[model samples]
Target: MKLVKEVIARFPADAAILDPFSGTATTTLTAAERGNSALSFDINPFLIWLGNVKCRSYSVEHLACIQDDARLAIGRVPSLIKNDNWVPPLFNIERWWSAGTLQVLAALRAGLVEVFGEPTEDRTDGLAWVAFCRLVIETSAAAFNHVSMSFSSETTHHEVEHVTYLYLAILDAVLASGSAQLQGTGEVVEVDARAIPKMGRRFSLVVTSPPYPNRISYIRELRPYMYWMKFLKEAREAGEMDWKAIGGTWGIATSRLNEWGPNSKVLPEILTDTVGRIAESGGKNAPLMATYVHKYFYDMHLHLSSLPNVLEPGAELHYIVGNSSFFGNMVDTPAILAASMQMLGYSNTVSKIIRKRNCNKALFEYDVSASWPG
Candidate 1:
């Protein structure tokens, strides 16, 4: 938020913000908090739901009822355990939780279903936010210290008393965030960044962290949540979801890449050069990784080329992107994006080193700033 706020403040205070790759909606939420209209888009429905949950308005009475509803939901978990061993429809589900913890989380899922019923676009998200927090923050063994989530060293965390206490704590925090005085509304759409709608909507700023060229697939981190929330009903759906997302190369998607050729005529040669280096490196998964890198930049180019049509003249754009490494070869993602923007008619391009990422000493996140010509 500090980064997003800083960039947004540079533009006109009344400037509406656009985040084409609004993953967690950090930019949109920050903009809305500051009374700036925020329009965000994502290919992942779960992320879209999450962004909406963070920015939507909540009534005081509704917040109170959510707390009561959550308590009622959690209390019903004991009888609803269904032998305390059922797992989600996810494949290799044990990798996410130990038996005891999985059982408790499963019961909580059933409880949420009973209490919240089916989720609709206009439904109250307070309890759903609680369940989201519980799943990601409390029960899941997933860790995000690295570039992607890793499942290791996750001890079984169970006990109805502890679950109850944590649920209450999370509910309070959710209610608190929902209680903020929002002067602007956040509109989150489940759509691809590559094809943002030209719905007569023109934004003054484009603040987003488009997925880095790094091979980390966002879907890998989201499978646990999507399955529990019923966005995904089968395991194969994960790979299918990733395939639709730009730069996605997870299950089934990886194999699908083998059949993919570059969008050669439109993309610059630098991308192919990088892919060639990675493919010829003899590194593990080199071929697939190479294709992943090519597809990422190719998709980004398609997205960049469309920006001028939607943004207001002279609108500033800030992309928080990161460099990636395949084997020992470093891919300067910011540089590639800056060049792409230049070709697409954006000017005043600058790539500044923002922070040294802790994941790898050589990897750094860059503030790639540019402006669409007036």
Candidate 2:
């Protein structure tokens, strides 16, 4: 949030900000809070809902409505749990949440759906879902300190009182921090970055962070939230969703990547050579990993190439991206993107190390900025 505020301060108070890679809506909400109208796009529907939830303005009455809905929902949780009919059929559900916990979540979700049914109810439902998602994660057996997530079977899910109290507490904490008057606001659309032009709206500033070239599958990381939100139903569905996203290599996405090839001349010799080196790394997964890296850049190229259609003349873009290492070979993704921007007729392309990550001495988060010439 601090980073977004600092960058947004560089733009005008009324600048129309655009974030095509709107994960969790950090840029969108920050822009709105700073009095700049903003639009955010993401391929993930869950993310779209989340962006809308966090960016919407809430008055005192709206806050009261949310409190009422929450209390009503909590009141219904116990009755719904007594019936035990609506537990999500997530695959191996116990692997993440215990039986007692899942029942409470199911009840709370059902209760929210029932109470937040007014057609005029705007962000209330979305906010409740966010708090519920936090509750779900906090009480689960999953631990998230490392890149790879792990679970403990011996975990003890929080009790009903704990879940209910935590859910309300999360709402209070997030609302307290984010409910500053919305000086400027805009809508969030569930769309691919490459399709931004089709939205038929032009933007004055771009503040976003594209997915890194790392092999981590965002879908794999988001499974728990996606499952509870009903955005994902099965393993195959998760794989299909990941397959459609940039830099995604989860489930069947990895296998499909093996059959993928770049259709554009977006990669320069340095990256093309890096791909070859990774493929020759002498492991069964090496070839697949190589394709994963190649596809990420190609998709990003498509995204960058499409930005001209949606950005105003001389629109400034600030992308917080990261470089990656594959088999001891540096992908130099930020520099590669800077070059690509210049090749695409953008001007003043600059790549700077914005922050150094704790992992991998060679890996650093980068700020790749450029201007689109009208």
Candidate 3:
């Protein structure tokens, strides 16, 4: 948030800000609160719903009524999961939550559907749903502090109090935060980053943190929320979305391994060298890793190439990215992105290491800053 403020300070108060990969809407919310017109896009439907809810204007009284309705509905509904009932297939529920806990969750889920109906673009149902999602994690056996989803060694149990009161409390907090007076207009859309040029609006600034080249599967991480919200119905749908995402590991098939090919001519030499070395290492997963790395940079090349069409002359761009090491080969993502931006005719390109991560010696986050020629 501080970085976004610092970068936005360089432009006029009315300057438009764009975040292509607006993960949780941090950049969009920051820009809107500062009285700047902001636009955000994400391919993930769940993320888009989250971002839209965060950006929307909500009434405290209306939200309070919704909270009351939810509480009442939860009391009336019974805890029941039939054999034909739908549940997220990401993991076994018994492993993560006690039977009693799942029963309460099922009741809450049914109550939410009965009370709130499906989420629509016009109402606060999306906010209510997000609050439920929060409750899921807070009451589950998963370690909430970890960066990734991790189940406790022992199953965690929850009482009715945990589901009812906790959800109401979380909903109240969400309402309190959403009641803030927004200074500027914020718009969020579901679209691919490469399709920005088609919007036909030149932005004055761009602030985004794209998915790192690491093997982390964001789609997998979001599976629970997506499934619960009905954004994704099956594993095949999840794999399709992951395949279109910028950085993905689990969805790439072996037959399509050769499709990623070599590095693009516009990228830095280090990227090509790193990919070549990884492919030649003869490790079990080396080829897959190499393809993933190559596909990431290649996708970025296509995305950066289109930025000029939607950026105002002299507009600034700040990309928060991280370097990664796969199979002991370093992928200097920031440097390669800087090179790609320069190749796309962006001038005054610069890459700076913002902070070093403790998890890996080779991992370092960077800010790749550049300007479109006026």
* C-alpha TM-scores of all predictions: 0.92, 0.93, 0.92
Report the C-alpha lDDT of model 1 over 53-161, residue by residue, as the tens digit: 8888778888888888888888898887766444568776676777777777767767877888755456765455545545544666667765556777756766767
Largest lDDT belongs to which candidate?
A: 2
lDDT of 2 by residue, 1-374 (tens): 56678888988898899999888888888888889999988888778777887888778777767777788888887777765556656677788887777777777778877887521225454666777788888888888854688889676766778888888998787666555888899668877886555557788899888889887777777788887777776789888888888888788888898678877675556668778888998866788888888888788888888888888998999899888787777788987788778777999999888888755476788889999989
lDDT scores in order: 0.79, 0.80, 0.79
- Specify the poorest-scoring 10-residue window by lDDT in model 2: 117-126
> Where is model 2 more than 4 Å wrong at Cα?
117-124
Query: Candidate 3, 303: how far from true, in Å?
Result: 0.6
Question: Which candidate order results from sorting by TM-score in descending order?
Answer: 2, 3, 1
Model 1 segments beyond 4 Å from truth? 84-87, 148-157, 358-361
Q: Which one is best on TM-score?
A: 2
